[model samples]
Target: MSEADYFKNMKHDRNDPNPFLAIFMDTSIPFDEEAKAIYLRDCSSKTRQFLLPLLRPLARLAIILLQIYKSVVPNALTSSKALHRVLYWGMKTFVSPSANHMILRHFYLGSEVLQFIRDNVPGVDVTMNPLKPTNLEPVKDDLFLIHDLNLYNFIINLNRELRDKGLEVKKRDRLNFGAITSTRIPIEPMPDRWTNFLDLTSAIEIFTPVYQMFLTDNDFWRATNSLQLDETVGLLASKIIGSNDRLALINNKHPMVPLTTLRAGFRLVLHGLATEQLHALLIELKHKQEHADLSWNRG
Candidate 1:
């Protein structure tokens, strides 16, 4: 039931040292940090001005904090008192105390905390689990598993390595990823961000051959539908949550299937919760997950 046991079961044959990337696309480009900071702040202001007129004051704070977070997060992921105006903005806009509190809840704002850990904190482990509910009933054809991961951080250790030598360009990024354990940053390992950054910096292509990187329906569907899955998978998945994405290729009839299933899975391992708290959790999951959806270009 441990993560080590779970990852051990994977059918990994690749000698690819960097994360086994399924790069959707990779053209050589150049990109940096200071430039990143300025881009972040500009984008924040524009978002606030645009969202302000239509939203309540508290909602306005939600938009604004995200901006301040961008400005301050160039260094860490925790809230910055230096830019504490977000609080003032929220209270001013959301007059309903309950509504105002909801808008400023820490989890949404805790994105900064995550960033802080990534930059300043040291030695934190993150776990991800994939335990979304599927048809547990004996319906033969209706049985399909939609597994999503939960990330936990009890034991991952991180240590930074600089100017790593002897790395072929293709392998450089993976080494850095490997070194990420001893550090306290909680950034996810999803290919779109960190891996892409590495590829851009090292001039290595993600999913270079593109064809092999593509996930075949057979590859995903068969894996999902497997009834004999190791039960320890959920625990294993929890260790990798931030590093992986919750995905679905199910029939379009169930657009929200992934989140719904995750709701069920939460009940299985978690229990004895207050009704109000549980209710709130589900609501946030629904709202944030909608924001989490991705768009892809048809090839």
Candidate 2:
């Protein structure tokens, strides 16, 4: 089946006994061979497994040190050069080329799915404000601070709306972008490699394991589980999306769950903020370079 057709036919049962199986049962979209090989190698590494416990404490120390560093030099973490170097080092040391390829490809595929939903779903507001890279300096830090919470709110709100309307994208008609008129088109186009900056996938892979340490089993399961197309429009939608509601109830003396989930959620929020700052800094630098190149060519 075509990629669009494959996504169209995808389904998930929210009441499934095994959430993991529900999310990954569709193996039609295979992982890249090299990515699979690297994943297997890491999983089988005795040394890596032994060092895994050390990472949790080290990650906490790094966080404390970063806070101190940021206080000492306000712009240290936000500096374009600093951001670029960190991204370079992380990609070179931690991320594999094949993994990067797979990450970018998933992005493109995810975008296609979203576009399909926006086009087909009635009354769905998928429109987002255009990112003003040039005017981002003033609120760049603030943007990073709330990136995770903002994403959480977005997913929750969108899902709630979908539920209220009794609408779903997966249940829609088959996606047919029409027959190709040109024989020159490739069956599958490769995504461009993101060499200059850290993408979301790489950032999540690098940081989430440490963040996972703070979460409860329920919260951890929620964090790790993947969502279907109809679920929050392909984002990691879960029961924990209702955590904010639970928090409000707890504040009103009607506690539904332990306070630890709240603490764990905040840690994830901070992780998202820090990751976004790095991403935004690199993006700002990229835009500046492009502008400079254009000006130089004109001169």
Candidate 3:
């Protein structure tokens, strides 16, 4: 089916026990084998296998340091323009053009997914007002900001709903990021055509380790179980571009989940280390390719 038609016909039942799972079971799309191959190679690389165990202690230490940093610089982790600027420069300088496109596309995709959940799921009235994507010129900083605000609002709103359901996802008492602004920034509609170098499942596999490291155990479980974001994203992805395993992996259990949360945490640390290595390699390859093109043009 065409992309536009897919979204038009997308349907979810509010009465379904798990709307995300139900949606995926009812839909099917073609798999991108090239993207799947890249994901599999990175996940199974010998370098990653060797370093997984070694990174556990370092990951623990890093988490402790992160807590210390958060205490010292309370606003550092909070959503702000300054943080966005740093991220913008980092992406422009180090990330490949294809990777940058994928990253930006993620913001748009995420916004749609969140909106879908809010509208279809009962009792999920998240106070999100994302800015329109009118122009991609200013390096799409506005789009990034909108995505961040949407995520922030979604979490805050979802937490409130969970509290009403008697499942408190314990958090810091002083963790308030203040009220969300009502003003909306204008943006253009998503382009009709864009390169798809990376699929959603691959992107999820790449970032799951980093997410596991950053989030506390309770918060992580609450996000996965209570919010069911994984299933929602998996469903959204499956409908657009099918996962190699189809909907088989789209469930309540996290792909990284192990015998215990503790073990899962350690395994994720290794995964993060491997991801870093892979990212560095990509950056280097990008630079080399650019240099080769420059030389050819000069000659």
Candidate 4:
């Protein structure tokens, strides 16, 4: 078949033999692969921090307007959207600072945590004495505990969920357990059949060298720079996703990690002193990433 026809056939899943997308699905982790697959599915259901950038300013604006109205006007304004904005702010205020992921209007139970915390962990004890500090030093002026009772309950629920899946903390695979160390809250494992996760993310170390070369590949880089196509290309490179899920994918955008990588979500990285060749290449990569990030799928 011709090259265009070959790529067209690859248009489906990573199961297709296009090396660009195949590596994502072919690799396996030491733990049960199905469990990894379930983890990916749950992660996808929750908005991912690394896939897309959030328009937090807009959310902030909605919240602020609602707050001001609540302060002076009191019960005058009662639109459902306004109620939502006010509720959203309260939820964000109570959420753990470590929650780097996007806070959606959905996720109703998130609000329940605050209520649980306040009901149990009040600012004062039975003697009516103020409690300990609000937050960590420098982060918040006061140290406050969000009522450990709720957190204890959350842990209970989380553990129970894992147990129901036939996974016990005592018997959990070391590989999957270790992955949780890298994240704040441990994400649930995939069931036994889904992900072919591998421990050697290091073997993927070849990625850095390969990315550097791609950074320097001006002609090839130029061909891949269009925002419209870059989305699809990034999805293909990452596996487990494709560009058709536009908004969902963009919200996966994570923070700029200091670690150097070939393609952190499809952006090439080059590491070398400022030689003209590499300097020009870095500039090109930055441009390509910025160009790729725009919502070209929209008008």
Best by lDDT: 3
lDDT tens per residue, model 3, 16-123: 544333333432422222222233333443434564445555555554555565556643434334444554444444433333443443344345445544443444
Q: Among these predicted structures, which one has the highest TM-score?
A: 3
lDDT of 1 by residue, 187-247 (tens): 2222222212211101101111111112232322232222112212222222333321221
By lDDT, highest first, what's the ranking?
3, 2, 4, 1
After superposing candidate 4, which stretches have Cα over 4 Å from the reference? 1-39, 42-54, 76-299
* lDDT (Cα, tens digit) per residue for candidate 4, span 60-135: 3433444454456544533333333433332234322222111111011222222222223213121112222222
Higher-scoring candidate on lDDT, 1 or 2: 2
Residue 211 lDDT (model 3): 41
Candidate 1 matches the true fold with a TM-score of 0.18
Clashes of 2: 0
Clashing pairs in 2: none
lDDT (Cα, tens digit) per residue for candidate 2, span 1-299: 43333333556556754333332343332332233333333333443345445554555555455445444664432443333344344444454443333333333333333333344456666543212221213122332223223334445666676788886644332322211111211123322344423333334344543334322333333443322112233222112121122111111121223232223322432332232222222233335556777999999
The model with the greater lDDT, 2 or 4, is 2
- TM of each candidate vs. truth: 0.18, 0.37, 0.37, 0.18
Q: What is the C-alpha lDDT of each candidate?
A: 0.24, 0.36, 0.40, 0.27
